[model samples]
Target: MGLINMATYLDIIRGTYEGTSEENGKRLRDALATDAVWTEAAGFPYAGTYVGPEAILANVFHRLATEWIDYRATVHTYVADGDRVAAFGTYSGTYRTTGKTMEASFAHLYRLENGKIVNMQQFVDSAMVRAAMD
Candidate 1:
């Protein structure tokens, strides 16, 4: 199947966090290609370029699972152009260490191929996240 458009992509995003079930995680994982690349914005705690699904799972998802409580991305808008999708949203979470809740606007850009995400780049307010964690 060809890569999905922005609406379907957003639906997939919502499905990932709709429940605390392994099925959601599996769905999210299934959308990623093995050779996918994820780039986290610099200055964030887990900032770096993660290559491949395993590396992304370790560096990005693992950190989110450990460091934040009730972490959620509330998408406000989506724009799609061919296989590229842009999602505008806010990340809301409580920093596990400080117990301080924070909300930061973010833009996530994704490139998909054959219904799988091949690359992603995230933009967010690193300073706000740092302050929340402090």
Candidate 2:
């Protein structure tokens, strides 16, 4: 398959958040190459760089499973060009560890190759999270 258009790419990203099942996660994984690299900005305690699909599944998704009672991301804006898509959104959830509920802004940059995500970078309002925990 070749590169998917920007609208299609946005749809896929939205689907990843909207679909509430392992199947969705699997679908998202399928769209990602095995060697994909996912990086999150510093400041957020759980933020770290993850390489490969398996690493993201283990470190990012799995960690989210334990930390949040419920988590959802709402897209505020999306821009795409060729094989790259950038999304801005807010993630809201209840922190399982401290029972602190939060809604914070975030932005993600995704690079796709042959219809699969090969790299991703994320930025979140970690300072707000830190204050919420205090």
Candidate 3:
């Protein structure tokens, strides 16, 4: 008989953040299911539901990389329930155009299936993020 292997939802979600930025990104992209959907907060600049890893990279992560300086999401806590995991954190960055910095609380809720993230929704203080931009 062969043993079955599995990773808990918490472990899968936590692995996405508890690594170097490059590593984290790689882990995140690797963890996304082919048809995964990522939602950005309504008031945020990239406010839309992006589908698939390529779409997410183009719509969100690539913009963040190009538009901010020293941008970081510092996760403070994580909660896992069933197939959902929530990460509570603070986002800090300096807007490249305005040269202003802001820090705001943020939360990300993720739903997983078969060890891959199927959906993710972000909650953040868009005003705080916009303050830095303006």
Best by TM-score: 3
Candidate number achieving the greatest lDDT relative to the actual structure: 3
Q: Residue-wise lDDT of candidate 1 within 30-50, one digit each (tens)?
A: 888889989999987789999
Q: What is the TM-score of each predicted model, taking all chains together?
A: 0.85, 0.87, 0.93
- Runs in model 1 deviating more than 4 A are 1-24
For model 3, how does the per-residue alpha-carbon lDDT over 1-134 read when each residue is reduced to its tens digit?
A: 02312337787788888888798899999999999999999999899999999999999999999999988999999987777889999999999999999998999999888778999999999999998998
Off by over 4 Å in 2: 1-3, 21-23
- Could you tell me the TM-score of candidate 3? 0.93
- C-alpha lDDT of residue 33 in model 2: 85
RMSD of 2: 2.0
For residue 104, give model 2's deviation from the true position in Å.
Answer: 0.6
Question: What is the lDDT, from 0 to 100, of the residue 81 in candidate 3?
Answer: 74
Please, what is the whole-model Cα lDDT of each candidate in the order they appear?
0.81, 0.79, 0.90
